[model samples]
Each structure stands twice: as C-alpha cells, then as structure tokens.
Target: MEITNDLNSTFSPYSTTNVNATAAPNCTDWPHVPMTTLIPAIYSVICVLGIVANALAVCVLAHSSASRRTVANTFMLNLCVSDLLFLLSLPLWAVYYSQGYNWPFGNIACKVCGALHNLNLYASIFFITSMSADRYLAIVHPLQSQSARDPKRARLTCILVWVLAFACSVPTFYLRSTQHVEALGVEACAIHYTSDTWFYTLTWLKIILAFLLPLLVISCCYGAIGRHLLAGTGLLRIHPSTNAPSFKSQESCCSKPEKPLTPQQCVNKGSSSSGGRGGGRQLEGRGLERVLWTVAAVVVSFFCCWFPFHCVTFIDLLHGGDPMASCWAQWTIKNLTPLTLCLGFSNSAINPVLYCFIGNHFRGRLGGLCKGLCACLKARGEDHSHQRGSFSTRLSSFSRKLSDLKDLAIAEPSGSA
Candidate 1:
C-alpha cells in the first residue's frame, strides 16, 4: 500500500485501489457552504439530545415492574441501551469533523468509534424489526399460542442480538486505522482494507444485515398488520363474525385494558367470551387502528432517516469513475455524504419519541418522569434559598458588632490611652 504525502490529490472513495489512509477527500472544489462546520455542529446537537433521551428511556424502562415487562418494553430497552452506546462515540466524531475530517484521537479511538457505529446500526434495526414482529403477534395472531412473545424469551433474544451485533462489528473495527496525510496536514481515520475482497464483503454485509433484511421483515410484519386492520373497516372479510359490527361484543373486546397484557393475556382476552366469533374479530381490528397509525409514523420516520445513508453507501461503492471527473457530481458527493451520514445518526434520537407516541403506558411513564424531575428541582431550589438566607443573617450580625466595637474604641482611646 502506498502512503502518499500529497494532500492535493483527491481521496477517491470509489476507487478500485486503496484510499490514502491519512488524508480525506480534497474538498477545495466543494460548494461555498462550510460543510466542516455545519456537519459537526449538527452531530454535536444530536449527540447531546440522543444521550439524554436514551438515558431517560433506560431509567424508565428498568424501573418498570415485572408485570409491566412486555416483550415490546424489552425490545425498547435494548434499543435505548444500544442508542446510548452509539451516541457516546459521536462527540469524538463530532470533533473529528470539526477539524475538517482530521482525526486527532489516534488509531484506537478510530477503531472503537467505527466499531460502535456498526454495532448500533445493526442492533438498533434488529430491535425495531423484533418490535414489529412482537406487535404482529399481538394484533395479527391474537388467537394463536406464541412462545416468542414471552418476556423471558425476549430477554434472551436481546442478549443474542447484542452479542451477534458486536461480533459482526469486529472486522470493521480492525480495518480502521489513522495515518497522517502530510499534504492535507491532518490525520484521517478511515477503513484501510488489506484486500478488496474483505472490503466488498463487508459493504454488502452491511447492506444486508443493517438495512435490506430488516426492512423486509418490518414490511412483512406491517403488511400482515395492515391486512388485519383492513378487515375491521369492512374492506376485507376475514371472518363472518366481523361482517356486522356489534357494539356489545366490540365494546367488551376493544376497551384499552387497565393493565398491560402479555401476548398470552391478549389471546385469552380475545377468546374468553365469544370463542373467535364476530365480536372477537371486530375487537382485534379496531383495537390496533390507533396503534397501527403510530407504528406507521415510526416506520416512515425510520426509513426517511436511514434511506439517504444507504443511498450514499451505494453511490460510494458503485460510482467507480473519477469523483472529480464530473464537476457537479463531485461537488455533490463532497457536500452530500456527510449530511446523509448525519441524518442516519439521528435515528438514535427518533425511536423514543415514536415509542411514546405508540404506547399508552410508555407515555404515562414518561409523564411521571417529567413530573418527578420538576418536583426534585423545586425542592433543591428551596433548600438552597434557605441556606443563603441563614448565611446572610449571620454575616449582617457580625458586621454590626464590628461597627459597635470600633465606635467604642474610638470614643475611649483619644486622650486617656
């Protein structure tokens, strides 16, 4: 591998040969906007907000009672932890970008940061897919027995996911190294693949493991959910019982339960009265209408956030021509890639908002958390005020005594002393 000292040469990301390890793309031809400034600023804001939100989520989810421990909650918790983990790496990247893509943190930091990004990318999407499947079981297969929805099984699944995600990220970590580009006068942290085979393999693996496969599973789960929901609105005839909407059966079946029910409880709730009759079918469909809408919002948001990033990855891989050979496209690539990656990084902050929107219980818990925080601050403020008042009173008294003593000494000391 040739280590070049010339920084003016373009760091061709799409080249068939190895990228110069020390320098990044020559952005002298880039658009007028300050990409180096804007990208890091945006990433810094995201890091702060994501860390705070995910930390709060961890607190809320962990303190939840065993009875409230639904499979959805388990997946949500895993998602938060992974998001928090990934967020921890962003500040380093933020600094790296702020310095015009020069990574001062050295090779170890570069490798760790890269590995964590991949870990969270894989883990977060997997958790979302798992969550969709959980909802599918709850809504679509309401009458069936499902062991996959058990809380214990969900825990095991989360462990397996984290372990797999971490293991899969090892190669990515090892491939990243920092080298000083004397021409650029900066050190760039980037993937320095020893062989082209590994580079191509990892790129495709990332698409499959992190993007395409997860999207496919989520789409199918939501598709079934959509079909189930359609039957309730009389668009489809899933059962003869659901044909005529009867209030008596529908009312009993669809009312939001006071307590969160497990998947088993949901099955029992659906089958206990009518034994899979018209009323049960009607209840199942209507019950998911609001939830489905929230889930739809979440799905849309997830895709919108991540789609640009995957597109950029595809471009970086497929557009093998000289980046600067085409003027407009080169400028576009120079300016476009960082924004796409920033958008992808924002997903860590979006999921909690979606969870709160989709979940009745989660919203309540978040509200309670907010209220408790306000009360704590209020109490602490009162204590601080009281202490200040006491100290001021003592200081005033001491000053008055000093003044009296000085006056007495002045009056008595003039002639007699």
Candidate 2:
C-alpha cells in the first residue's frame, strides 16, 4: 500500500527527513543525525520554557481583579492558554523525532497530540488578531468602541475563538493514527488520508486560516492605527494661530468677553498658548512610539517565526514533485524544513515575553500582584510566629505547674511519714 504521513509539518504527508527506505540513492545522503539530535533538544527547551512562562501568565491573568480587566488583557490571557495547549504536545513530538520518527505512544496519544498541535495553530493566531483589533478600536475609535471593548464581551469572544479552534482541530483528532511503516519497521504518528483531496484541502486550510488571514487582518488594523496617529501628530504640530478662521473666531469671542478673566484663567490661557500644547504633544508622541514598538515587535516576531514555515509549505505545494527525485525538494527537506519547523515551535515559547512582559501596563500589574502576594505571605509569617511564641509560653507555664504539683506531692508524702 502506498503510504503518506507527517510528524509535525502541518498536515502534509511528505517529509524528506522521515526515515523511509524508498528514497532515491542521492536523496538517501540527507543527514539524519543533526535533525534527530537538534530537534529533540530544541523542542525540549521550547516546551519547558513555554510551559513555565505561559503558566505564570495564566495565573497572573486569572487572579487579576475585575476592575483591572480589559479587552487586551483578556485576549492575552487566552493567547497564553493557546500556547500552553500546543506546548503540552511538544515533548511527544520531540521524542518521536529523537527516536528517528518512531512513535512509542499509542494511537490515542497520537490523536490527542496532533489535535493539541492543531488547536494552537488556530487559537494563537485568532487571539492575536483579536488583540490587534482591540488595540485598533482603543486607539482609533475609543469612544465608539467602549461598549464593544467591555471585558465581558472580550471574554465571550475568547470563548468563541476557543470553540472555533477546537472545531478546526476536530478533523485532526479523528484522522490521526499510528501507522507501522514496513520500510522502517516503526509506528509513526501522523494523519493518514485515504485520498489526495483531503490532504490538500487540510493543508491549504491551515495555511490560509491560521497564517494568511490573520496576517491580513493584523496589517489592516495596524495600518489604520498608524495613519490615525500620524494625522493626529500633524494636527498637534499645527499652531492655532496658523488657522486664520479659527484665530479670527477666537479674537471675536475675546473682543466681546462678558466678565474679566481671573488671574488663574489668564495664566492657564498663557500656558496653553505658549508651552502646554507642545508638552502635551511630546507626551502623546512618546505614548504613540511605545504603541508602535509593541505592534512592530508582535508583527515582526510572528512573521519571523511562522513565515518561513508557511513559505516552505507553499513552495512544496506548488513544486508538486517527488521529494526523492527532485534536487530542490531534497535540499528543502534536508535544510529549510527543520529550521522553519523549529522557528514555528519557538514562537509559542517567546509569546509570553512578546505579548505580556514587554507591555508596561502588564508589567505594572504583575509587579502589583507580586507585591500583594509578598505582603500576604509576610502577614501569614508574622501571624505564625506569634502563634508559635504564644504556644511556647503556654507550654512552659504548664510544665512549671506540673513540676510544682509533683514537688508538693513529694513534700506531702515526707510530712505524712
């Protein structure tokens, strides 16, 4: 029977690095040692760090008070959850590749792991896109989006994303299985498609739904936000005196003033006309710069990590050549595939740093939470110390009373004698 399967490169079944004995003689020269060694090691590191970082993020977000909650924070919390779901499956993939594409885990394990992997791909991107949308609304349509940006609505949106992501992953859970490759004499955990149509359909779906669509949405949001900020900055730079009509209107209003201005009002007008606008603009510019930096970091990191993998997938789909027969295919499978896969996996690991740790507001909240925890711990410690001291005092007094009674009993015996 002709077989097609994949370990972790989307749902594509053709893997040049997989240990298949049917490859062409020249293609057989592809090095397996580096792939087996480095994939497991890098996967292990990513899994561990990703888990810890995301877990901490979950805890912090979960414990945050309602008053402190916002749409962005809610999306970030869900993003962390999505990364964690994917990170949970990394160790199994690590071991699978480490053992030369052999899957020790049974069929069910394979399905569960694959499903989790699928979940992360959709969930993470969706959550990120949602965050970008929330920011766009906040910066560009602050007053208009107030009702839409409520924390309750954000939580509901997160629930919808999770459900949608799970729905996307349902196919993976059902179709994934462990097949024993006769050529290699090992069971490999991968999706087995009975037909080419299903294989291509799913692969295209992953690329389009998970990567391209989100990228497009993110670009539109940030692009609009950037233009809005630039426009506002331009307005801030233009002095009121530069506009003849507005200056004339202000002069007319001043000419018919009903009451004499107070000293405080005069001082405020002087400051506003002189230095206040400049100072305000300077502050606004700094805030805008921070927002741009954050947006750039998120977009750049995302592209760097997932773009290569998607590019390879796209090219492979277009190439439509036999991996063992084509030199370009062989080179890609041996070289670009592993690097891109590693990059894609590392994205989950660094998300906490990129999304949450870099945000000044997030840092402030985290710091406040840490301080509160420390204070609570300190209070508990002090209470425990007081209880211990009181217990010791009571015990000492009881011991002394018992000794006195014994002494009195001995004296009574002696006197009776």
Candidate 3:
C-alpha cells in the first residue's frame, strides 16, 4: 500500500489547505491539525529514534565475525540497514506534510523518498518472512535443514531480498513526480498513473506480495511451531525441571532408568546428578526462553504496526473515492489514515528493539561495545595527561639546568675578580 498518497485528492490525509478545492469541490472540512501538525511531529520522532536504534543494531551485528553470526542475525542486520534507509526519507516527508503537502524538492527526491517507503515495506516483510522460516527450520526440522541454515546462505538470501524489494519499488520511482496542482497552485509530489488499471494492478501486487503472502507463510510457520511445542514431542521437549530443550532426553544425564523408581529416589538421584550442572542448565534455559520471546515479539510487533494501516487501505479501496460514502468511511479515510500511516512507519523504529536489543545476545554485545568505547576514551585521556605531566617535568628540569649554568657563570666571574 502507498502509505503516503496523492495529496491533491480528497481521500489524501495530507491535503489541508484547499489543495483539493478544484478537484474535490464537494469535500469540505479537511483535517488540518492531524495532517500538518501531529503527523509531521510523530514522523520526526520516529525518524530520530529509528536512525539511532537501527544504527546501533547494525553496528553490533557488523561487529560479529562471520563464523559467529547466525542466520537470524544475518536477517536482522539486513533489516537494520533497510530501516536506516527508510528512516532517512522521513524528514522530507515530515516537511512535505507540514507545508500542506507542498513539494519543494525536485522530482528526483520525490521519487526516491516515495520509492524508499515501498522498498522498506517489501524488504522488511520479506526479511521477517525469512526469519520465520529460519525459526521453523530450527525448531521443526533442525537436523534436516542444517545446510539451509548456514550463515553464508543467509547472507546470500539477504542480498536477493534487497534486489527483489528494489525491483518491486522501481514502478514507484517511475510514477512519482513533482507536479503543480492547479487547485492549490503548489507543487506536490504524488504518483501519476496513466490508467486505473495500472493503479489497481500495482495495488493488488503489493497486497499479495508484501502483506498476504508473508502473512500466510509466517502464520503457517508459527502455527506449526506452536503445535510442535504443545504436542509434547519427545524429539524436542523442554525439561520440566530446568526448562532446557531435551533434544536427546533418552541419553541425557537425568534420563529415567529401565527399572521403576520411587518419586523420592528419582528426586534424590536428580539432585545428586545435577549438583554442579544445575546453574549452567538454568542459564541455558533462560537463553532458550529469551530467544523464543524475541522471535514472538518481532512477529507480533510487525503485525500490530502494519495491520491497521493495511486494513484502512483496504477499506479505502472499497470506498473507491465515492463522494456518497458514509461519514464514517470519510472520517476514517481522513483522520485514521494519517495515524495508521505513522503507526506503520514506526515499525522500522520498533524492529531494532524487538529483533536485536530485546535479545540477551545483542544486549550483551551492546554492553560490551559501550564498555569498550568508555575504556578507550579513558585510556586516551590518561595517556594525554601522562604526556602533559612528563612534558612539564622535562621543562622544569631544563629550567633548573639553565639556572645552574647561570649561577656557575656568575660564581666563576666573581672568583676571577
């Protein structure tokens, strides 16, 4: 969906100041506050937060060696890059909205900014789909999907995703241009399609590829994962006591014996056997839970952010620019559309927190990075201080030597007299 639409139209959330006067004469009462005030403000905030968070995520991920990076981390790193690029376009959008949808920047910038939105939409969803697939393979077909889960393959997949997303966005680049709107006499940036067929075709293509297909794949993957976890499959089960995955419980140290034992006996044996290992087991269990939580949060956040916007878009599509549409539909199209678009845009900012900072691994890495930076700064400060101190000492010693020479000359002259 085009989160930002042609502001010269009646349905657009950005047109407040008579920009649609000639085109939409019947439509009165534009939402000036939301379009010009709230949206730009929110977009600015999201832009700042997204750039910082995603940049940190990218730094942390990039710091990892290739061998240490996992398939999920590779996808996450690519997601951060996509978010960074997307967030970079938000300031221009904020300015555009604040100026009553006027486009002062030339045609090239208009196209680039508009295209980045689509690129981000397609790329982020595809990366998320890749992540869901990776999780599915990791949990459901761990032994069988080893080659597919390789970090190298994941990197290659990310490259392909970028290419595909850019390819999908090429149309937006071609169609977006700056034009002088006769109604408002201001230059506006919007997509100009030759026919309704082109518009409908692209709209359907976006709905199918970016939303529907990804939703289906992700839902199926997560559904199977839920079933697998709930079915109590012996192949991969969490230990009741430790909560750690028991991939080979039959061969585990706490495995049940062939002979039946009393509950007390089993308890005593488990305690004695797990004496020194209990701490490690507990840590492992927590790590596993963290991973699960991170994955679930990422998926949930994506849907929560984009679903409403997509729903509104679909509703607007059904309304189809009908002047006789219900007041509710018109209100939704005007008021809620901008809010939902901001919500969708905020997802890029939220993704870094969900996909990276929420995990213990990334948190630890970030902590290490911070500490390392602090240490470097401190050491440099100390080195500079030491150098200054030594320089002062040398200067003092030289002054003393010069004073001694002067005294010696004076004493020698007095002795000669």
Give candidate 2 regions above 4 Å deviation: 1-22, 28-33, 232-285, 321-324, 410-417
Q: After superposition, which runs of candidate 3 have C-alpha atoms over 4 Å from their true positions?
A: 1-22, 25-32, 234-295
Give lDDT tens digits, candidate 2, residues 254-355. 444686554323322211111111111222466567656766777888888999988887765664434444655645644566668788878898888877
What TM-score does candidate 2 get on C-alpha atoms? Answer: 0.79
Q: What digit string (tens of lDDT, one per residue) describes model 1 on residues 1-417?
A: 332222211222111223444333455654565766887799889998898888888888888776566677788889999999999988887787678768887788888888888899889999998888776776666435244467788889999999989988888777777766665687877766676577567767877888889888988887877777765652122342453332223333345478554543333333211111111334345455654576587678788888876775565455432333345444544556667777888999988777643455565677888899999999999999999998999999999999999998898878586
Q: Model 3, 88-160: lDDT tens per residue?
A: 9889888887888788888899888888988998999999899888767766765457566777888899999
Off by over 4 Å in 1: 1-18, 21-33, 233-289, 320-332, 373-417
lDDT of 3 at 76: 85
Worst 10 residues of 2 by lDDT: 271-280
Global fold similarity of model 3 (TM-score): 0.81
Please give the clash total of every predicted structure, in order.
1, 0, 0
Best by TM-score: 3
